[model samples]
Target: MSNQPPLAAADLQKTQQGNQVARTPEQTLVGFMNQPAMKSQLAAALPRHMTADRMIRIVTTEIRKTPALAQCDQSSFIGAVVQCSQLGLEPGGALGHAYLLPFGNGRAKSGQSNVQLIIGYRGMIDLARRSGQIVSLSARVVRAGDEFSFEYGLEENLIHRPGENEDAEITHVYAVARLKDGGTQFEVMTTGQVNKVKAQSKASGNGPWVTHWEEMAKKTVIRRLFKYLPVSIEMQKAVVLDEKAESDIDQDNASVLSAEYSVLDNAPGE
Candidate 1:
């Protein structure tokens, strides 16, 4: 081997640094979230009740609990988190407000999974209540043995009596929204109708739809009811986002699914 000249101390240090191994995806994600710029972006997107630090902690905790999330497209994952924060909902927590799920992007040659945000039934209810137009809202799955009857007309009426058998098969789902002005709106769907909606969801074969079938069914009815309720714009956006996540449609030719939430245009090391 031959060297034209020995590297200076500063040059040697620079060379060594340049040759260092790159950070793992997990490490890169954590570092990016900790960056001052990313933190500011999160703060700007988050509501007043949540802080950037808390949001970061929750996301990091979720990534640790589900390592697959670390493998997701970093920007898409961050965008989903920002969407949750903007909606005042926590992601991947016991509250079941929202979920961060990974799905294989058909476009990725590397078979990389992209993250999708699923809003839970509870999350939907929370968003609706935030509108302040609703005094109370609730959804339930009716079992085969339950006493249920509902009539929809000028005088809409609904009545249900729970069956003693707690394990009865689910036969129907319904949602009732009580408005602040003493008006009530309700929607009832037979299990067949709910199944039809489920069959159309790209995520029906997995994620919350599989693990939380009853919850998903209830949310389906509530989603139908939302169209008639006086909900906030954020709530409307959440519904659209939820539907998009379930459908997994590609509006643009991006490798990963894009959400409507505002996110940092340039992620770290982009």
Candidate 2:
């Protein structure tokens, strides 16, 4: 509909090149993670033993190993990594300290997924020990063939004997925490109770609940036991985060990592 004549080929080529130069490069998960803002947040939150660069490398490797992580909402993924760093726990490795799991955001029209931070049973114990009140903390799964018994009131006691059947069905899981003051506290849950907890969880069908059922069961009992232990504030917060992850609650976006940092919707220059 324009009356003006078409531009010459040279002018058209120059315009196209200029547009190309003006366009920003597509941001990859690694690049988004490496942004100065993200790096600064990580450096400020990480413990003395951990460096932002090292944490970034760990997250980058995790993304590579689980491509689904790359597809997760970048802000949530970064926030989860920052939370792990703040707690001094390594994610997605053989250490089993913590994990970053991608979960579909059912509320999003685009079906964008978010990353949920899962603190492992080992991670829970690690945090609890930092309080200096606990001398030893451990969790174990009792199989059908194992001889296990316990008491609750005065003269409380527990006894367990190993059975040869390594593949025997799990009958119960328990966690015990011995305090520095020569006191011991423990919690035990039957398989039925553990199953009820799992059924209530939104992630019951996936994540550690699937691949590491025994570990998760042990963690569940440990969480119940923590109610009586003198754990640190960080450990308390970690438990809350773990519960939110299991329940698939969306209210954690603003408070998951820390009150100081807000999860950005997009990387800079996007």
Candidate 3:
């Protein structure tokens, strides 16, 4: 062992303070979490894509990538379209359509888009595991929890329509999340409506899409049962289409673009 001189009183105090801060990171988090206002804010800022984190850095990074339609619709528009693909919405083909809408539209309104998404089974399982709920998806549901869905609906006057030069008042969007039925399952739905779609071009046009607003609602039922579900190996195909694709909502449109996703080893739950 090497001989060492004793620390001065001032030095000892400084070292103790540094260790206390380093070791209490969890405490720091909990201190904020314990605040009712903080809890409410967390509840309000729920993620649209399953279990993504609520941290600003993580959330904004995902949003910057052509955000999922849901997240982009709910969060900052400019933030969502950051270098995202350009071929998915209209002018953008699969190469462009990373998100539901164009990234960095150059004309972002306060709130113009709203997208809905479903959480993946694997993500939910991971969350349950982290919560110490050891149960299979096929087994009797061991985790009964509530979740709040979040999306930025078009409210106020926004949306430059397709052809019209004038913009429209977007009004406010109403969204809510709830546990389905009297069971451990859950779902989110739109309660208030979006109104006032405006045209984009100076010439008269079809304006913005106004129909299909209620198409997202799900009839609620009490969930008396559920099981632990495994991560689906079937993979997911983008059922969406761009203006270049044939058929509007249907008809198989062969994607001319490649698909990708972030490495999700430590991703969060729904």
Q: State TM-scores per candidate.
A: 0.82, 0.81, 0.22
| Weakest lDDT window of 10 consecutive positions for candidate 1 | 261-270
Worst 10 residues of 2 by lDDT: 261-270
On lDDT, the candidate that comes out on top is 1
Native-vs-model 1 lDDT?
0.72
- Candidate 3 lDDT at 93 equals 19
Candidate 2 TM-score to native: 0.81
Tens-place lDDT per residue, model 3, 1-270, is: 111221122332343454544534223322333344433443343323311123333324333443343222223322222111111111121211122232222222334332222222232222323221222222111111212223333532222113232233222222111121322223222232211111221111211132222211111100111111111111112222222211222112224333332111222222
Off by over 4 Å in 2: 1-27, 106-111, 251-270
* Top-TM-score structure, candidate number: 1
Which pairs clash in the backbone of model 1? none
Q: Where in model 1 is the C-alpha error above 4 Å?
A: 1-22, 108-111, 250-270
Q: Count the backbone clashes (under 3 Å) in each candidate.
A: 0, 0, 31
Alpha carbon lDDT of residue 12, candidate 2? 26
